[model samples]
Every structure is written in C-alpha cells, then in structure tokens.
Target: MEHPAALAGPPIGWRDLDRVLVVRPDNLGDVLMAGPALRALRHAAPGARLDLLAAPAGAAAALLLPEIDAVLTCSVSWQEAGSRDVPVAADLDLVDRIGHGGYQAVVILTSFSQSPWPAGYLCRLAGVPVRVGMSKEFGGAGLTHWVPSPPDELHQVDRSLHLLERVAVPPFGGRLHARVPPGAVRAARVLLGDRGPYALILPGASCPARRYPAGRFARVAGRLASSGLRVVVAGTAKEAPVVAEAAGDVPGAVILAGELDVPALAATVAGARVVVCNNSGGAHLAAALGTPVVVLFAGTEQVGQYLPRFVPASVLTVPTGCAPCRQFTCPYALECLDLPPERVAAEAVRLAARGPVRTSAWSSVREPG
Candidate 1:
C-alpha cells in the first residue's frame, strides 16, 4: 500500500503530517529513552494529536511524558513469542482500531536487533498515509520512509532522534523526561515521612540475568541502614519476596514495592539521597529525576549504551568474555553482577554525598492509602 507521494514524486513523510502515531512496542525503559524523540514530534506537530503505541507496561510509563497526549496498549504475541494467551484475532483488532484512528503518519522506532518491517506493515494495513521506520534492511513497500538504523552501540535515546531526523523531526533535547505529578510527590512524602538521608535500593530487574542476588542487595541495604541512612527497597508487588529479602532485618528500611506507580516512583527517586539499581527502568527513572545512581551493570548489554546519563553514576560490573550477549539469562552464572556488597555500599555512600537531599520536600504531606 504505497502512499500517493511514492507514485507521484518523492516519498511521503513529515511534510504534512498530522495526527501522528508513534509506535514503540517495547518495555518502559525503552519508552522512557524515546522521550526526546516524542518531544520532537510534539514540537514539529504542535496542535496534532500525538498518540503512543506501547506495550501494556510501557503504556503506563508513557503517560509520564507530557508530549504524548494518549497511549494505546498492545501485548502482541510476537513480543512474547509462542505465548498461548494472545490470539491472532487480537492483532487483527489492533489493526482495526488503528485504521479508525485517522492518523496521517506512523513512526516505528525499534531496537537495533528488532525488525521494523512488521510494525510498518501493520501501519500500512491501517492505511496510515505515511509509514516511517528504522531498519538496516530495505523496507519494501511497507514503509514510506525506511531510515537506516544507526550503530548498535548508539544509545537508545539517540537512536530515536536519528529515526525522526529522516522525517524532518529534528532533535528537541538530549534529556530523559518524566513529569513528577504533584499528587505522586505527596504520596512519596507520606510513604517516606520524616525519613532522613535515605538510599533507594531497587532489587529487581527486567530479567534474571540483570538481577543481582536479593541477599547481596540485603547486605548493601543493611550496611547503608546501619549507617543511619534509611534504606528504601522498591519493586513491583511481584518482587515482594525479593524486596523482603533486601529489606527484612534491616532496621528502618521502607519497603515500597507495589506501592509506587510510575509518577510516585519518580517522586520517590527525586526525593531519595541516592539510588542503587540494576541496568533497568528504575535506573533510567532515577536519572530522569536528577538522582545519582550506583548501577549493578549486568553485562548483557553495553555499559555506555544503557547506563543512565546526565547524572553522577558509579557502575559496578565484572569484565566477562561473553559480554554484550543480550541474553535474557546468563549462562556464565551471572558473573557480570558479582560485585561485593561492600563495594556497592561504598559507591552508594559516595554518591549520596553528591545526590540531592530532599528532607525539606518531606515537610508536609498526606499519607498514601
């Protein structure tokens, strides 16, 4: 389904784009990294309705971006290949819904390893007049603008802007963005009432390969808490056991796992003295909130590519032969995240001095239910 521009003259793109749909069917961290590109789209099409197509978890996180007016969620089967839950009909319904959205352009941003043609094809099927995507392969007829993907080592934040540049959407800014809702800031204050000099320990990661042992996290938290710094261990509710293993027996350790939503989490990160986390979304979120971090850099990906930037960072990772494997699980017994708790604690303490002190922000607030 080639657009009229292909048949008439030069290929279609940003020239007359309105009601644009940005598709990034990935995790929260990926969506957060794409913030700069989203802002560019908002700037280019000021009055246009900018909708984000994200995975369910990504959809929730995407709401934090002020540039995005709305989020449409999809847990497509291909995202979790061989899953019996998502039927073919579900994908068809997504096409139907998007077709009725009246979008003039669809920009498909993908990771270096991911193929953008499938997403471009769906947008084509939806009759979006202009389909823009990034890939190394020839885009065939599915995409009107097949922008070549940048180097694998290019940061996800930069990669998004590179794709948009092909469509005349210039770079807006080079900063990770997330608006901390006032209500969520209040919630953070209530949850962490009167706690002074707290360090946030995020004990969970998107995959086991990236997760440092819960017991190791506990040791770090215990060391920090014992030093009169309140330790706040956070994760999803499903990470309660991991959170407990990290927070239990640590005096004055606050367990906010399952308590903070995206906004609340942003506030909590903003209010913390320092954040110790894996190479995960929490690391990005903390960076967006202007907090220093001590990252347990699992070697599944490049250190410079994903490690949070624009903030002071202390990364702890062991050199491994199988680095950049990009595997969900480490075959080498997770050697990359094998840093000692003492080292992690020391880094956290060092960063805490440089990180912000938000005791004044905790002065007054209602409790979170």
Candidate 2:
C-alpha cells in the first residue's frame, strides 16, 4: 500500500460549495480523530457552511469542536453482508433526510475495512454535486472524486486528514482541540469544588479486552490518593459501577460517572492534572483537550491506530508473543493487561510526577505483562 504522504499536494477548488456535509457516522474517538480534517476543511473553504453527520453518542464530542457549524444525528442502520436487507421505509427516510439538507459537497471518512458504500449511495441520491471519499469501495465508484484510504497501521486522525490531501488541502500544524463552553466549565467547577488538582481514571473501553482489571484500577486510585493527588473516576452511565468500584475507599477519590454531558466532560478532562485511561473514547477526549494521558493498551489492538498522539503521553503495552492480534475477543484469557496492582499504581504515580513521558524511549523499554 502506498503512503498518504506520497500523495500529498495542493488543494482542489470547488466552484459553488455553499453547504458541505462531513460524514463520520461512528464512535466518539472516530469523530474526534476527524477533528483535524474538519478544521482543514473549514480553513480551505471559509465561506462554505459545514455540518457534521454523526451518531448520537458521538454528537457531544462533535458539539465541542469549534470548527463544525452544526451536527445532524444520523440514525440509519444497515446490516452486515450476511444479514437481511434493511426495510424500505428506513432507507427512504434516510434518503429523504440527506436530500432535505441540500449539501453541495460531501466528505465521507471511514475505516479501511468499513466501506462507505451506503453513505456514498445516500450522498449521490441526495444530489450532492461533488462527493469525495476514499476510492476503495465499489460503491465509491459513484462518487464525484475519490482518494485511496490509508493503510491499517496509520493513525486514524492522520488518515482522515490525508483524505483532504488528495483534494490539495494543505496541512497547517493541525492539533486536536476540544472546547469547553463557559457554562460547562462553571458546571465542572461546581461538581468538583475545592478538590484541588485531581487525576482522572477512566476504566471503560468499547471493547472488553482493551479494559484493564477494575480491581487493579481501584488499587491504583488508592495509591494515587495516598500520594496526595485526588483521583476522580469518570465514565458514562453504562460504566458507572465500574468507576465507582475502581474508586473504592479512597478518601479524595470520587466517581463522576453519570454526572457529566459531553461539554462538561470535556471541561473536566481539560482541568485534570493527569488522565489514566484505556484505549477508549475518553483517552481520545483527554488528548483533544491537551491533557496528559497514561493510556493502557492490551494485546487486542494496534498501538499506532488507537494510542494517544500527543507529545506528553505514555502508552503502556504488555507484549505477549501473540501481541497486536487486533481481535475483539481474545482467544486466550486477557493476560496482557494483568499487571500487578502495585505496579500499575506505581506507574500512575510516575506519570503524574514526571509530567508527560515521550514514546521515544518506548522502543527501548521492555513490554510489561
């Protein structure tokens, strides 16, 4: 596969693109990864109106982005290859919604394995004059323009940005930025009053294998609290019990699991002294907020695609011989993240004291077990 860098060049000009729809209908981290690309698009076409189409779960992070003009929720569901066909009304409703938007250009961002076929088809049906996306899919053949998708190893943020390179959009030192509205910041202050600087422990991931042991997290929180840093456990409503259990018996440790919405969550992450999290959405959120992160990676996924990309972050990965299998279901028990609770706590303390640790030394460091 050719590198996206090899294809980088000048920006393409569109004649009359008053309204542009940027499509990334996926997870929170995926939407955040598209931030740089969206910023680039806005910079490339300042006059064009930009709207984001995303899932409801990802809408909060999308709303925190300053570059997006509006966020429209996309609830379309299409079955996988072996599943039954979607109902006609659902398909027609989706098409009608897209058509009603009246966008001139549509940019579709997708993972390498996942085709943008349905989205591309919808855009074409909506009468979008100029449709642009990666040309890997048979359905993408209908697009007005197509660029090749990046290799699997490439970081998702860079991959999304590379799509713009095909159309000649120049890179301008893009960094991820998640804004906290004034009200959200005030709300965070109220929620965490006089707790001083605290470390955030995020113990949830979309995939089970990527998550570290909750008991280990609780032990780490206890140790960090002992070391004089308040530990706050943060998660969504679904992960409330995990967060609460992880913060067990620690005096200054509190669980803000179900308390925050997206903007407030961004604000809370922004104010944190350090964030310890899995290779999950909150990890990406902390990175976007420019907070220091200690990201734990199990053997189930690739470090390059999901690890935090900020300068002052450390990725802790345990290398087994069968590492980087990228499986959602670990065939063997999850031995990769089964580090001793004391060791995990010590590492968290080290991360808190040393500021941001660089990955430059990672090549020399031995893999943990």
Candidate 3:
C-alpha cells in the first residue's frame, strides 16, 4: 500500500490509494442514501479496501452494503439531535483507530443540513493525509479536497455522488442498493406466518416532526385491510407502541415491531406488495428493494431533497404556505398531517395493485409530486 506522501501530486488519485475510510455518521436513511456514492468509490478503486465509519443508527445498513469491507460505529454529538455532549475519550479513541488503520484517504459524507468540517478535522487530527468532504464552512483548511456543496434541490443520493466526484469517483448506477440475506428473508417470512401478499406500514420516524399521526395510520391500515390486503405494521422496538397504535384492530393486520432486525426488515419490505411509511429509513430501504412506496411526508419544504427518487413513490403532503419549516416542533400548525388517510390509502392501494416496480422508468411510474 503506497502512502499518501509517496504520491507526487498534492491531490492524490484513486491509483495512489490502497484503503479509504468513508465516514457517514448519521441515521439509517442517510447511510442508505449514500449507497450510490459508496458503489461509485468501489467501482473506481476495485482493489482498494472500502470501510465505513457509521453511527449506531446506521451501522446495520453499513454492514448490509456489499461494497463496504468493514463497519465502525461512532455516535457524534452534532449528527444526533439533543444527545449528550461530545465524549472526548470516544472522540480520541476514534482518531487513534483511524490513525492506526493505515488508511490513505478519509471521505466524510454529510447531508445538506450538516457541515462536514468537524469530521474532516477529526481525520486531520488522526494524521490522515488525504481528507475529503463536501463543505462550505471552516474556510476548507482541513480538507485536502473540499468539494463545494451542491444545490439544495438536489436529492440526498445525488448530493453524495457529487461529493464523491471530488475524488474522481463517478456515480455508478445512480440508484439505491441494499442487501437482505436469504436467511433474513426466511426469518421474516416465518414471522409473517402466511405467504399471502401484504402491505407494509412503517408508522414511526426518528423524529416526531417527520411522523404522520397514529390515528391516520390506523385508518389507512383499516382501509387497506378492507380492500383484501393484509396490513403489516413494522418498526423498531422503541417504536413498538406507535406501531401497535397504527395496527389498531385492523382485521388481518399483524404488528411486527421490535421483532425484526434491519436485514429482516429489508426482507419484509422486499416481500411486500407496497410500502406506506413516513419520510424515514423504511422508505429508503423499500426503495433499495425495488418496492413501490407511499410516503406521508411531514416536511414539505425538503421533500425534493430527502425523498428517494430512484423508486416509484407517491409523496403525500399538504404543501402548507410555510412548508419545509425543518423544525422538530411545528409552531403554527401541523398542516402536513392533514394528508387524508383516504388519499394515502388510495395511493397505497393503487401501487399495491401495480405490484413491485422493477423498471428504471421511475418518472413514468411515480407521481410528479
């Protein structure tokens, strides 16, 4: 493995790298959206060992990505909202680990709402020679390759691809990718107890601001059941209560919250006729599995940016005058929740009837909004 110092140019290319550490310390949805960029890095440097430094929420998704050779977990204070202060010991430990990993380059991935300067500084502290990130902050001092942030209207996946371009890694498939092992699929099938087609409803989000109302989800589940589709409510253990509320006495509805892991959840989404979820990780996982999705998006302003574009999805939002507030708590009103259950159920039913969407004509299959 040639060291960065051994390379002649100030900015080294993929040929000069033997191993790269890609840092995406955020939630599951964020990591899933980085799939295309990860693939691009792998495609460009096929022999280079690609590793991921992910947050706990995103660790499982990182492990599931075939392109990643290793996964490291790091819960940063800036990435998670309202968390404890930065753990100085943990931060130093991470820096020490990266310094010892013999990495040639460290690529820090961040969302439009986040600044990558902090992660880049950490890499620099670890003595990583080639530090790269997308940033407009910190005067771009720490980054060897500071890619300017793209337009806000760009989708999260597209933004990641743009960032990877700083290292000359082009977009690979321009799509989301995930892996659900056959064993996980079998386990999920057993949990379902029946082979009949079912509609998956993810009724929880990482933040309350992004979640649809529980009652509305229940009504939608009932409507789907009434239409002869089995409803399956799935979420994490922490979200079990919300999932149970959403599954509310809907005939033929099964509540599997807290029972499935990420891979199993992916398998469940892949097996479903369609997925109805909040603007959360479930929607991204469904998109990766090629399942049609109906998203009850509570944040209208950033819909074009966060929502997955590579899948057939119907995004339902009220389009409030002050939409895209990007606030955890709505000040005036929760206008986005006004998306009627009837409308959402109609969209889900329509997509279910169409079954899984396999073609790349995503625009033709999905609604413009």
Task: Kindly give the number of clashing pairs for every candidate.
Answer: 0, 3, 1
lDDT of 2: 0.75
RMSD of 1: 3.8
- Tell me the whole-model lDDT of each prediction, alpha carbons only: 0.82, 0.75, 0.81
TM-score result, candidate 1: 0.92
Point out the worst 10-residue segment of candidate 2 by lDDT: 359-368
Model 1 lDDT, residue 142, Cα: 84
Query: Whole-model lDDT, candidate 1?
Result: 0.82
Q: lDDT per residue, candidate 3, 30-64, as tens digits?
A: 88988999898888878899999998988899756
Those runs of model 3 whose alpha carbons end farther than 4 Å from true positions after fitting are 1-9, 138-140, 356-369
Q: Give the TM-score comparing model 2 with the true structure, all chains together.
A: 0.88
Which stretches of model 1 miss by more than 4 angstroms? 1-16, 82-85, 359-369
Per-model TM values vs. the true structure: 0.92, 0.88, 0.91
lDDT of 1 by residue, 200-279 (tens): 99988888899999999999998898776889999999989999998868876789879988888878887778889998
Ranking by TM-score: 1, 3, 2
Best by lDDT: 1
Cα RMSD to the true fold for all candidates:
3.8, 7.0, 6.0
Write the number of the candidate with greater TM-score, choosing between 1 and 2. Answer: 1
